[model samples]
Target: MNQKPVNLFNTFQLGNLHLPHRVIMAPMTRSRTAQPGDIPTDLMAKYYAQRASAGLIITEATQISQQGKGYSFTPGIHTPKHIDGWRKVTKAVHQAGGRIFLQLWHVGRMSHESFHANGQPVAPSAIQPDARVWIADGNSAGQMLDCPTPRELAINEIKAIINDFRQGAANAIAAGFDGVEIHGANGYLIDQFLRRTSNKRTDIYGGDIPNRVRFLEEVVETVVAEVGKERTGIRLAPYITQRGMNDPEAIDAILYAARKLDRMGIAYIHLVEADWDDAPVIPESFRRDLRDSFSGAIIVAGNYTAAKGEAIIDADLADLVAYGRWFLANPDLPYRLQHDLELNEMKERATLFGGDAEGYTDYPDCQEKAS
Candidate 1:
């Protein structure tokens, strides 16, 4: 008995987001925002509009506030000017008949003092990651400076940051985004608190799994209060060990969070797989556990080829699959996949970040490729 082939072009309804297909575009940092205030530009709008074929396009991780910023040139949702800038982006995407979600981001310990009001980056504890973040410089891809030790956030400061996230979500709505996706993954602020490796706090925000997940719970609750749960989603990485974050119990802790989020009725949970080669494989048992715990749509993104994604969706492991680098190079990715067309390889490694139209907006579509 032969089963019919699973189709990546199948339609999926994610919360209030009506999609044309299941080929979602995962968020990637291009570091090309307009300078002076880290605002989204017409160039950025064009870049997103070009990829309107995606079922859902999650914008690059955007700083929720000035203190939330970690990298160079990433957009923000903290001010009137920022909202105006994002308005252009959302307008562009909507006009192209696409739905886009702005990912609210805060770097936490994966930051440098230069980005802070005071000369200290705040985190769950005084510890820091052994990694670097991109900063503005004359260098093509910007300069990667080592992260410094951070100051532990006071309980008052933690409460303020939660308000920042809530305001950010409200601003995303004002900016005309279809919704907001909380950046709780990739060893960023939320991930910093979720794991025990970086968070050494003795306060209510750390210690046991329930305590560690407290900040996440508050942030989500606030954001969902600002924008309905159906319009809010979160990204999480249960197996990633980057940025000196190796949480021994991350898998279980995240599954617990998943159950909680399911009970909250959020839009979806994007599972970010480690992007590096030879990354840890999230076992099938874990996937099954996650599926059972979270009743909402599950979006998995990693080294997914079309066939691999189709297989995962067919198995009912995930409702949708996201593509990052491949979607960047191939703007008409869904069309290519639907017609079995060859994809364009990445333009140039040098043009991936902090570049101009060459790599950002010049990726040819299938029609152009045919010519």
Candidate 2:
């Protein structure tokens, strides 16, 4: 007799937290933080609280330091004000009975000069990525600006950034976050160090696969030291080739890092597959290899529908499924998906980035719409 297949709504034990279901709310940067200081606002708190039914809500990429910032109006975790601001968000989420994780990020070369005081973004090497980051205009509207050639970071700067990750983890705990997810994907600073296309250094942190993965290992070790391995997760994008991130050896390097992360006993490894309409499919062999390499939980995100999510979980390829755009529009995403209810369509593309409650908190749930 065959065993029952795993359902999408099945309860999952992810590290120390016991999730109610397997539907995770993936991280999406909405550039809605308070200006001048990049602090979380009451509106952001309400927005997160509205979607508290998710198994886990991984917050939008939050900069760990001022230098980690790339896009405008994105929140930071480096300052007293930021911590206080995030406390409000955490309190609201907890009151609403939700678990949240802050995604620690540093954009590296995927940044413009305007965000830096010296007008130079820092990266593992001086390579320039063909990427554009959103910078808000005078009217608070955002524009995608091209990134410039970034300055290569010194050995000391790399160490400092690792410490920044450690501090960011500590600050997230102080702000009452359940955990932290290191943004090691999508051509960010950590991703830059992992790929040969971006990192062209001769130091110990460059060259072979082991050297390339050293920076990521160090960052993870430091964060785990700060807030235990159980509360730490990481995101990796092996199939993503956009924004000058098409590294041929990226898969091997990520797998090598996954082995190390498995030994380190981190909570989960979130893989971001390419999501474009015509994006290449991730090979099944890679998935099996990844599962073999990492014994902990695995979360997969990239335009996954409810059926597709259940299929992956049933196949034992991934433990949890994260919905990004779907969760953005449907605050009660899990309920709707579980009950086969109609989802609220996303409205006003302009409001997706740096706007107010029009597109953020005003989306009605199934009950609200019925009433």
Candidate 3:
């Protein structure tokens, strides 16, 4: 019989980095990091290595500094221990023939005092949103708590956060990552700073759209300086409205920013369509605008299947498709796509956020059956 068609194995490139397939693994918060300000652990290395067949794997959002943390048990890239932990992860993934990128992040006002290093939450503005964050204590299972009022960031302090991102990129390089991806999404510090609803400031970091985007631009430049433009990537959830964060001109703003990054020669622009499964459609005009504006690879994520992912790539709207939840239940997701095999059901929602080895590294692979 003739071989079945599988667009999942289609090769692509982000700048000079050639990928064997277009199945990019979406960044996920596994919350398995070691205690007292979540540091990457041996389990993380094993977890990532198991999923290394992904054309590219973007690690869970890693806090760049202590203030960057919003939840307990999430990994950080600030401390020496964190870098050492991630070094093992990168080595494992590399040995498995996978490419990985470290996503630099800061939660800003989305955090509570419990997760902070200085016992205070920081934000672009002093406003508090109706959002909940997960908290963890040894022996007492994780629970969701309401977000607290945040302190407004000073101009100088804002500059310091930019420097922190630069330091994070440096640490990521030391950790042996192939590249760094800026987490300017999901109501984090950069997204909080960029969104007009969350950011009500009079400084240069706020005001007009360009001004709101200044912090992200500075961060991109900082990381590019450390790792060079060819190895830099950015993850944006522009359409997702969580924690009262909204950008009326999100598409325009990000596309405009994409043009700038393209001109600067940044690697990829990974866009998360929405927070939920039934995400709103991105207009053809807008998709084309992004395609025309950005010369580098474009990766789109948010509950997409192999067929829909292939359709997007075939239409030239995206260069690659990122699998979020599907990648969680299926380790050999690319192989499954190649063979058109049935995907495992993901019925356990509570098992996602915080856990030990179960429900995480326990996901069986397709290769196991073949053997």
Q: Rate the local accuracy (lDDT) of all candidates.
A: 0.90, 0.94, 0.85
lDDT, residue 349, model 3: 67
Ranked by TM-score, the better of candidates 2 and 3 is: 2
Each prediction's TM-score versus the true structure: 0.97, 0.98, 0.95
Per-residue lDDT over 1-371 for candidate 2, one digit per residue giving the tens place of the 0 to 100 score: 13222488899999999999999999999988887899999999999999999999999999999899999999999999999999999999999999999999999988889989999999999988988999898889878999999999999999999999999999999999999999999999999999999999999999999999999999999999999999999999999989888989999999999999999999999999888899979999999999999999999999998888889998999999999989999999998888877889999789889888988999999989999
Q: What is the lDDT of residue 180 in candidate 2?
A: 98
For residue 66, model 3's alpha carbon misses the true position, in angstroms, by 0.6
Query: Measured by C-alpha RMSD in angstroms, how accurate is candidate 1?
Result: 1.9
Q: lDDT per residue, candidate 3, 1-371, as tens digits? A: 13443666788877667899999999998788887657898988998999999999999999998888888788999999999999999999999999999999988998988766666799989889779888876763678898998999998998899899999999999999989999988888888877888888998988888888888899899889988998899988767876897668777778778878888789889988874667566778988888899888889998787778778887888888899888888888888888888777764767787777777888888767557
Best by TM-score: 2
* Number of the candidate with higher lDDT, 1 or 3: 1
Pairs clashing in candidate 1? none
Worst 10 residues of 3 by lDDT: 1-10
